[model samples]
Target: MTTMEPQGGFSYSEADFRRVQDIARREAGINLPISKRSLVFSRVSRRIRATGRASFRDYLDYVSGREGQDELKELICVLTTNVTQFFREKSHFEHLEAHVLPQLGEKLRAGGRGRLWSAACSTGQEPWSMAMSVMAELPDALRMDLKILATDINHAVVETGRIGQYPAEEVRSVPQRWQDAYMEPMEMEQVSMAREIRRLVTFRPLNLNREWPFKGQFDVIFCRNVVIYFDDETRNALWKRLADRLVPGGFLYVGHSERVDCIRECHLEAVAPTIYMKKG
Candidate 1:
């Protein structure tokens, strides 16, 4: 068996990662650390080798403009590995059930609307699962009319997410009830999310690294599993930005491996093993 090389001892220099990191920061406000020297090189070194460039610097200059944007998208596609599954973090969903939804339901019932933002939705699963969780706890009236905004940097993935199709493996661990409620079986070893669930989510192209216009505040924002890709400054800045848009007493669900400690305003309350909410 051929083993992959360790993600260090990069062929490229730190300058290479810095250039890519600059692109990410300027575009999505995400920054990569110097420690990921190999990760940076591995993700982009092939581009250098493929183009037959003498150095990473030359290759970077080659990708400086319009064509560069295309290359940039390709880089992010490789570097931003958003590995997620439906109900992957079960406790957060449970906390949403046991605490959040009921109160949010009251707000919605009293002519208030509730909306959710899945900021880094990779392939529609997380946001779709969130919609299912909403439907599971919400009554017919509320569940029938829900709004979720799920955005991603990759336009292709964002478009795919809007279509609400996924391979069967993505939903393997999803509870049978929510799966039945949200997914309609299809041929080709896949399933199409039910129209009701699809209707609730709005998938859009958002460059989180760029200026974000807030149409409204969100009751919950799930930025889960994506922050580990960013540098400390970008992480802290993004956390602050997300906190600003989150409704007080609203929830912020991050990845099992990610933390929000640097941001002083929100206290991490461990309602679930991988789940956290903004302190009230």
Candidate 2:
């Protein structure tokens, strides 16, 4: 048995940090600046302890070696933040209710299917909110050809979204109307999203840097607060892909702090703050 060198039990070196950063960017298009070194160390340290590794160097080698594909994904999941709640950004949902839903409803009523995508939908809140807003506007949305595809790169958070249950405090911010219409009381101060609303959303695991499998385009896409972790080039590429995935006149909502300024080839025109419309 090889005796491991302990630099304060769970030592993290600059080399190990750089290696992790490189793998993360190459695999998931996430750019980790030097300021995030502490955050990365804290998160990856937990995984290192969980995996019973002696040092960060050993753990990094294991994850970077041949059999580390799924482990690499697990590492990404640990580092990726999923801080989200129901209607975290109210104006976007309001926009959905006022503009997007009406257009989708008209299409559905006119015998056409409608689709909404909640890309990087952390823990189901965003998609569920979209579903609730849509149902509130169009009572017959489920009966009509309507679907909400909610996807995230993290498998754990994707499972959380699929379950459609949340802590009561986590859901307290939900609007009363939506709470009454779409939530059922769960034990221990928890709430489960109504079955019908859950049915409206289909949860899937998606990595934004990878090629998307589906052929259909979306009438509305809410990909908020995700691209802030990417470099300029990666962010522009992602915006292009998102623009391509949207219907010609479809709506795109992003994070308040994030901007999509210069993807000229994507033909996205800013219509409002943090909102863009795909141009023909």
Show pairs that collide, candidate 2.
none
**Model 1 TM-score, 2 decimals:** 0.81
Residue range 1-280, candidate 1, lDDT tens digits: 2222335333455556677888766666666666666676776777666666666677678777665767766666656666777876777778777888898888887778788899999888888878888888884634434588999887778888888888887778888877787799999989889876667889987877668866577888888877776777778778888877777678888887888874455554545555556666
Estimated TM-score for each candidate: 0.81, 0.95
* The best candidate in terms of lDDT: 2
Give all candidates' CA lDDT scores.
Answer: 0.75, 0.88
Runs of candidate 2 exceeding 4 Å displacement: 1-8
Worst 10 residues of 1 by lDDT: 1-10
List the pairs of residues colliding in candidate 1. Answer: 28-209, 29-209
Per-residue error for 91 in candidate 2, Å, reads: 1.0
